[model samples]
Target: MSYFKEDFKYDLTSSIVVFLVALPLCLGIALASEAPLISGLISGIIGGIIIGFFSKSSLSVSGPAAGLVVIVLDNVEALGGYEPFLVAVSLAGLLQLILGFAKAGIIGLYFPTSVIRGMLAAIGLILILKQIPHLVGFDSDAFGEMEFFQADGNNTFSAIIASLENFNNGSFVIGIICLGLLVLWESKYIKGVKALKQIPGSVLAVAIGLILNQIFISSGSALAIGKEHLVSIPILSGEGGLTAALKFPDFSAFSNYQTYVTTITLAIVASLETLLSIEAVDKLDPHKRHTPKNAELKAQGIGNFVSGLIGGLPITAVIVRSSANLDSGAKTKMSAIMHGIWLLLAVAFFPTFMNQIPLASLAAILIVVGWKLTKPSIYKKLLAVGQQQFIPFVVTILAILFTDLLIGIIIGLVVGIFYILRANYKVPYNYSTGEFKTDDGREAIKIELSEHVSFLNKARLQTTLDGLPNGCHVMIDGSRSKEIEFDAMEVIEEFRINAPERDIVVSVKDLPGGKGRMA
Candidate 1:
């Protein structure tokens, strides 16, 4: 009620927008997953309403994720049936439940900020590229999968080329018209209209596309849009009869070794995707509210369990839908919930209306969404952060574009680790030249150790100590140090014991007690 009182209007309006954005994506991701289209819609409904209710996040939208398409497809092929795969998804949900209780979501903390940004940017670029073919009326390929290679036997770039070779003039015309209308809808004038603001631009663009498609067909033009170019959603036979769509997992398959392997793989990948999307969504939140990681994992786990029981793909928090919700001015989780309601209704009652919509019109809307992700400001900011951050960010983008998401993330992490170690490998001790009077009026130089000294600092320390003037008194202090690696301590002790050879009187301060060493 509080949400209704405070943000119901905004949430409801944004829900329709998200529902529009999510509809085609759900179908496209399902196509890429090689799963039944109904499975994708079921996951979307469960993800939004079920998971959104349980999650504390204000803006994270969950669904059948593009990141899992390859994994799901491969698993399906290996498992030999969709039912067995459903069992794996259910087991994965249980695994996520255990992980949530165990606080395994803490692993999200280790992903570097640069890598996360890189991931989002790469997805954005992929969105733009993947939609190009669709925008040209090339309906053979799927949209929103975000993989380097597509299900239509084409890679990202090759699809664009093929679309050039095979494209419909009507779809191209519709795409431009829809894109123009979308641009205008975001303008100040259109936004000024209260009623117009309530109706999302995507919905309008789709309506126009439907009309244009009808006109083209009626005119008997060569450029008329065909059935293949339009959306196709299976209509329900009747109301509240979900029994036909519901699919139960074959629990008997649990004994198979491959089942556990697929289950574990799904859990791990789904968890990573969820954590990453949550991180990205937080960045997009206007209120700057933080989501509880473990709670989100548990919510997703519960949703996947239900979705799996009813014949759905594994669910994860999805960044693209979350971003669209944020930009559309959603204020609460209710928007995500309502979007699910809309999806269910569309499938059950309004599928005929949905089927008339053109894919090119949807592509035009996502093109705008994709542009939002790879804004010039983002790249400029990353560049200003320096090479350590920018390199991993760019490397991640290239890796994801060339390989798969998981492999890309792994490569980005490796690069981030390299930067982390490079930063830490420098000397730890502070070198401040201070002259002190010894008992006999000799000048002594003192060096204080930092909290922890690793062997990586050995070279600099050796250089400084070796360059010290002969016959000078030197004090090597470690009183404040919590740890000193053996190799580093060796350098200090060697300097201490070899003092006479260099005609230098060396004294050790707070040297750690140990078994016999040269004193």
Candidate 2:
């Protein structure tokens, strides 16, 4: 009971920090998914409250993952509407449940360490690149859609250039101000500000955004955050009840093969992402917490099923929120539940207040999160680990930058495996005496060299054989040997040739053509 009480306090503080971080991410990811903003919130709430309660993880935070954005958008567009997409999401959740029950959660363990690290670094890089334009108040379309090459017309780099070319001075001013305040709050100077220390930097940034917006409104400036930039929840007014905003899935689309294919894709991708996130969060936990992977899968599946039924996008254990929770000192799962409850309450009672929060402010928070994940210090640390580890790490990073996550991982795994084989190939074999003894001394020697033994193992095999006593019988053991290389087999043959002068008999057993000993 005492332990529970202690953890409760920590959970409250940590959940608040996570909530602050998650609010904008929920909206951003929903926008990226081509789903309604409220749908994202609904998922967030269910993920936090419902999944949080059932999950065995103490540090993991669940919500809409950025990795699923492309898939979600494509599915929604293909399915024609959000209702049809919900049906797919529900089916995907059911598939994940089956996977968990089958103990397929262990599949995440097979991914190479180098590849996993590369995937994370790549995600961090993407987050930074994608969020930069938003931080600068240049949201041309939805969030996370800014690619290297333009999907429609402008690429990520081009979008940045265009934003700079037609920069909104008012929005830019507010963003810069909020960014500056956040920087100041994070600085050492704020250490002495005891009361202010409790306030999250995101909260302070939001305050600045609101103040700037009010000032702009008073001055008749055209640079305020427009309706497109703010979070839009479909709040039920007096005439329309809450049921008006709520939507159910249209299962009629389930008969379509495309719908089934989309659902399977979603299920596989979502499960992989969730399992990976669960592993990463466990690794990041300060207490060295071990999350039950199967339990987590079940919880996520349940959450997604419920969320889809209530018109929400699919949910998963999101790294961004989980990292924030850990960094903010969350001690147990209760914090996640609290955050979910807060999300529901805030939307239900304070939609008007949430609408006042500026997009730039959330963008600033994400910018900080991105920088934390891809800090120069992390790179320096990776380099300090030495080339053996660094080679694969660096390769993974580059592969991820050039290709997608799954492809990048495969490349890194191949490189790591090659390195391992190369390292192992350096060992030399010693069969000069033709007397190999097992550690238990129960197994006899059966020395048979390949047709082509290289010079690489010459010295090693030579040293081993030369150190043997005179009583041990030397055997050429070339029964199955054919076309032996001059460099390696010649060395052994030369030793056999000269052994007669050293009171040693070299006997060849079963030569290639059934010939006896070679004089």
Candidate 3:
């Protein structure tokens, strides 16, 4: 079908873009998890191919999420080994499957819009800050952790200073060249070059880095990508094949309480992150595609399930990869599948070439990604949404920046709920008699208005109307009312227009400050 053909073309483009972006992220997340570097790539491949097959989301890309880094690291250390932790991961996947089937995916709907937006903005800022050191040729062990400070005694700001102090000239030069090429590729000057436009900035950066690395090697210079900054996949000789890389879960650890706790924690965190990313990716879709939340949860569950069985980290719908996919013109889920295929082929056939790509160049690509997510325009738009929305939004941003994602979202939710309650408390009417006579000898609802009514009373009025019986003549005793709020008056006026449909009659008593007849 024409639809299928068009989708395939889009998928190919998206797959290439996401593949380039995902390759580095998989390694970075693995480093953060304190697991074998190969674990991250395996998760990425499984997430893309396996999750893609099951996912109802056409545009979302799945991978190991940065948000789970701290937990993953803690669990790995606590469990004594990555192999034992696989047991917990399998349990986590099962729990996620339960959550999806139970319709718990709807939990994302309860998050205040302001909080979600603020979270996104804060995450963008964090990504930019964290990637800066790498972009400038620093290869510290603390690559993907979200903490402002590193375990190596370097805070975010201090890390920048450190990178500047010990910057590697060779790596820095390569990074600058790559960054310049990326910027040029994105510029309007190249807009007319359709062929060039199809090439992803990330791909261009990698290609240039590879070329520069060859040049350094040929010149016998000390400016090559070191093992510290390259992906380290274990190469098995003597009858191992792909199975040699696979690690299985140790079910013997399931007896421990810590295993259960970690499993539940991973499930909850992974599910929430996936749901949030799915929402974001759908929003970013140029075609305005809608992704099914429940289905996405199931797909992530399946991905994590397979990942655990094969000794890989749990997977989630990752925003960075999904964003890259959208920006690369991904039109369907096939792009995600193609990305997985690329990862498989790269690892299986071109590990040597992939290992040569500089981490600095990939870091540069991520820097651009971080900037796009945290643009100044985001702040301006938040302000324009008004204080009622902006206050929670700002609080969420600050909380996320100062603390972590979970705590930040909690604080924002509490603040948002407080505002909602405060708004609800402003209503002015109180019920008087429980029963009143109707023309047909039935009880008529009686509402006694306070001295004044206001916009905040909208909920109370709506509640009263919702509870009223059909064919009831509601008596609103406003004789004692001092003033009617404009919003309340508007509600009454609108009701007057459609009162017949509801079979209700509204009789307003004496006007508060005037000698007017009851209406």
- Number of the top candidate by lDDT? 1
| Whole-model lDDT, model 3 | 0.78
Ranked by TM-score, the better of candidates 1 and 3 is 1
Write down the worst ten-residue block by lDDT for model 1: 510-519
Candidates ranked, most accurate by TM-score first: 1, 3, 2
Error of 3 at 195 (Å): 3.1
Off by over 4 Å in 2: 1-5, 77-80, 144-150, 219-224, 238-241, 401-407, 420-519
lDDT of 3 by residue, 1-519 (tens): 986766777778679878877887887788877787778888999988999999989888898887788888899888878888998888888888888898889887777777777777777788778777777678775455676656677677788888889777667888888888877877997767998786777778888887887798789898765666655545544356566666788888878788988998999999888887777776667777878777777778888888999878889888778877876678889899989999988877788767777777877777777777778988888789788788998898788777777778789888888777666654566675546666666456777777777777777786676777877777777777777877777776666556668877766666443233333
Q: Write the per-residue lDDT of candidate 1 for residues 382-440, one digit (tens) a residue.
A: 99989999999999989988887878989998999888767655557766555567775
Tens-place lDDT digits, model 2, residues 1-519: 986767776777778767877887787778777677778889999999999999999989998876678788898888888898899898888888888888888887766565566566666676667666666667775664423444466665677777777655656777788778877877888867988877767667877888888777778878766765654555656546566766789888887777898889988888888887787777768789788788788888888888889998888888778877876678888889999988998778887887776777766766676666667877787778776567887787777666555556678878887665554344433253326543433323334555445665576556655654543445556555555445665566666666666555445665443245743
Clashing pairs in 2: none
Evaluate all candidate structures by whole-model CA lDDT and list the values in order.
Answer: 0.85, 0.73, 0.78
CA RMSD of each candidate after superposition: 3.5, 8.3, 8.7
Q: Which stretches of candidate 3 lie over 4 Å from their true place?
A: 1-4, 241-245, 426-519
